[model samples]
Target: MASSAIKHGELVALQELDSSSPLFKQGASLRVTGKLQEYCVGTAIATIVDGSVSLKIDTQHLRDLNFRVGSIYQFIGELLIQSDTDAVLQARVGRNVDGIDLNLYHQSMHLQRQFEVDYMRTRTT
Candidate 1:
């Protein structure tokens, strides 16, 4: 039987959207944080950057949220990758995350993934 439980957004970095990452699955729910680089009010589109990676965000569903360029924000949404250089996040929710330490967050993200892998290896063995 198919589970009816709602799937929660998985935390992901923009860099993880590359071809090698498991989180590159289509329609996958994801939670990402980055600095807002630009926003087009007419088209309801946003551009956010994390380190050297930048991603387009479709903000049609999140019209209520205010997006200010140069502010840090976190977005939870569905991922859509059309090509190697084209990836968009259909954002469902977003909020400002100013004052967040991105460097520490990146380190924690790496540690979390390492722990998950180690835990899975133990379970399988």
Candidate 2:
């Protein structure tokens, strides 16, 4: 049966392994989930997942979240965990989210310095 969750360091298949042939032979899809968690570097979302929290990520560019959440999103990119026992969703790419305990939220970290940053912060602070 297909699992509905992922763990901190476990590996899950976000995309079909049979698809990426030859050059891009990434081990069973890609370990983007764990790597992304590492990539964030001390981000709360990743930390939460490690602690069995829930999370989500904006994957419009990933061609996944553009469709659905959870089960549907699983087909887009990749979900990973260190082991099968851990009940945490590690979405490598998607909007809705799943697996890990924490909701792995993901938004485009746009360096929108040119998109009017000062005006927005000034109003909030």
Identify the leading candidate in terms of TM-score: 1
lDDT by residue (tens digit), candidate 2, 61-121: 4432233212212323333333332222334443333454323322221233334587788
Residue pairs of candidate 1 with colliding backbone atoms: none
Q: List where candidate 1 sits over 4 angstroms from the true fold.
A: 1-5
The Cα RMSD in angstroms, rounded to one decimal, for candidate 1 relative to the true structure is 1.9
Error of 2 at 97 (Å): 13
Candidate 1: tens digits of C-alpha lDDT, residues 19-113: 67888778888999999999999998899999899888899988568888999999888889888657788988889999999989989999999
Candidate 2's displacement at residue 107, Å, is: 31
TM-score of each: 0.87, 0.19
Q: Which stretches of candidate 2 lie over 4 Å from their true place?
A: 1-53, 75-125
Give me the displacement of residue 53 in model 1, in angstroms.
1.0
| TM-score, candidate number 1 | 0.87
